[model samples]
Target: MNEQHILEQRTPQAGRLLIGLYPARYRDLHSEDIAATFAEATEGLNGRALLREHLDLASHALRLRLRIASTDPAGRMLAGTAPVALALAAGECLSGLLPSLTALATTSPQARPRLFAVEVVLVALVFIPWIVALLLTATGRWRRARPVAVLAALIDLGVALVVLGAYDRAPGALLRACALAALVLLAPPDLVDTGRRGRWEAVAVALATGVPLAVLMDSRVTLLGWSWYEVPAMVGFWALLVVSLLLLVHLSARRPDRLRALGIALGPAPWLLEYGIGATHWVVAYFVVLIGGAVAVGGVVHLVRRMLGAEPA
Candidate 1:
């Protein structure tokens, strides 16, 4: 039999589904060639091996469609930011889950069956997809996670809007949530390895996200209880602190590319959306001062490094 026939035999139905994920423009030009190549490569693979290849292929296809698989600095920047975005989504799920569990514990389902049922469904809709996506990304299957994350974000946005309209809550929290969800959806898929460093980075991100989120959720003043309007500013401050510490650590260790560092900085910056887009103007000047201070400090740092010959002029 010819190679085409052989390829047809090897390509499973799921493989065709992956190829179909490609854009129509690209598929029209090269789907057959791509499919045939994939089939030939996986001709003898089966079971877990085949599934692994399928996931890898799916990730490649997603990166292509998202236009984020390039080796260029922009692509690298997005790749760096994407994993953090997933971690933040996981953090949000954790944050929301706490209140949900509390409500379940305090409220009797038999006393208010309909209300309890609705709450359960809402929690499932808004949070489960994010947790699932986080699990997938943690396992290094980011391409498959992206679509699931997107679904989670949509559910979050929808629920936020409903809560805003029905309960008349301050839009600040909802808007910030929407902004963070948007960031998670737009970020490219992260290409992570099952390595020690990758595992550590994952843990660090989870801590960063969880710590700030927990602080914000606190209701007691001694524990950092701040109003919803204050959340953005608090998150922004935490992000800046983390960035400063990272910069200092890098100075003593191996320095990262400035551009990639900037991208990493952005992973913690969704809070800026509150003042900028959500119009929580009370914290506007606070961010301005923080930004100005950062710029001035960076200038001094660069000048000192140049004078000391630690960095290229």
Candidate 2:
């Protein structure tokens, strides 16, 4: 039989649908080739072999979609940031859950229902949309993802504001607000199509701006007396700092821009030192403070060079 006839006979309806799952541009470029390959691979296969073939096709389509998405700067940013966002969301949920559960268990029966209801709403507000947006972004659904992410950020900011009000500008509240605001700012809009370098630069700007604000707002006086909740909160805070640092390193390597790398690196150092000092780790805090001072000076020098229209050394 001819190749066309063979392909038509071997390619199942499900295989066609799986291929269709890829973006239209991708399909336009590779659909025929992919279909032909599928037909050839599945030829004369039955039952388990056919099922495996179908699974392979679906997997290939998913990989193709992701590969296509990775080509876009916004998509890359979304992909890189999604994991961290989800991790933060999980941490927040856990933090809320522990206290809420304790309150529920301790409260009188009459108040238990009210506490449980409030906890449920709080959990929903804190987690659902953020998690959904991360999943959607991972799957290459940027248009649908953007609004969901924005809603999640708004909800998180509102919660942070309430915490700030109740606790008189708590560090945790400020950090939460800054983190969500950073995410909201970084979350790519479908309208503006920027390149990878542009996206990384945007990330650098967001971190450089947000990190200092968070650091300044962090009232470290209470760190001498640690609460159980502070453990998780500290872990989340350090995780964020580490991620931001790694991102800066990546951008510095990938792009030729040194100014952004310097700005981001310098901006967070003082904050880290302050955290160490607040936690009473003096040796480390002193060491970091020295390093931060040097980097800050270097950053200042770089800024001066830029002002003079000279390339940074």
Candidate 3:
């Protein structure tokens, strides 16, 4: 490490790109220091070591920008929500699995073994790894869980490429797989600590996930005649509707844990996103009403607080 060499490596292009991922204000103040430190730390690294460093940097950058950093109460709320959200996404997948599999079986018989196998592989890639990650996280083994989830995500990407090459379309499961993997990996490891409370959260998430799975699988519970997929969306919409209404109450009441409650309310974000991606007319309306209603209520509350001299000048 001569001075010239150090200088050149001190602000490597790759490091600068990563530092750019930070918020604009933060990057302006700290990008030079951050890039210099990263370059120095990674000078001799290459191959998997270099890739790992890049992934870690990118993951942390995302966590900070997303408010899931694990240092603040709000971040802690998201960290706690991560595993539960993953479970809920997996449950959504499971809710539709039988119908999907049955359809594949009927359609692929004797003529499309390759396509059928690819689909099954896609399902396994998304579902099994997520379940394993959930189990690992639930049992307080985040160190193991993170790597497992990441590897699964990589495989999903690779399979997605192959599927696209062969069929000109990627599997739909890829989106959910990546979303859950990001949730598992970007979550601050320290925020989801091991202990009774951690175990209880995992346990509750698992049991709640099972309820949707059972109901969707039964086919007898179609009160609204909603499809298997729509059932979960309906369930999630109502759940969020209730949470948003409760959030309005908490906002008025000035509850201290309101931020945490908001985080919990957002736990269904992964499921909601999947639904929104290909939602039908009614489904889109459900989303709009919930989101619009929440925003309107929050605005009203803010105006009331301002009028009452309850808010700061």
Clashes of 1: 0
lDDT per prediction?
0.63, 0.51, 0.63
Q: What is the alpha-carbon lDDT for the whole of candidate 3?
A: 0.63
Show where candidate 1 strays beyond 4 Å. Answer: 1-31, 35-67, 166-194, 222-233, 239-252, 278-313
Tens digit per residue, CA lDDT, model 3, 1-313: 3654564467667766877788888776766666667887788888766766777777777777877686766677766556566555444445555566676667754687888787787677756775676677778887667766677666756766665546523543456457667777787777664676655565555545555565666666665666655454565564445445544553454433555545545666655655555554655576568755775777687778879999753
RMSD of each: 5.6, 13.6, 7.5
Q: How well does candidate 3 score on lDDT at residue 132? A: 78
Model 1, residue 212: displacement in angstroms? 4.7
Cα lDDT of model 1 by residue, 146-221, tens digit: 6677667667667767775565443554665665655544444453333565445655665666656665665553
Q: Give candidate 2's error at residue 87 in angstroms.
A: 5.1
Give the 10-residue window scoring lowest on summed lDDT in candidate 3: 164-173
- Model 3, TM vs. native: 0.58
lDDT of candidate 2 over 34-112, digit per residue (tens)? 8898878887988756765675466446645665234454344544454344334433444344555565567675656
In order of appearance, the predictions have TM-scores of: 0.65, 0.39, 0.58
TM-score top scorer: 1
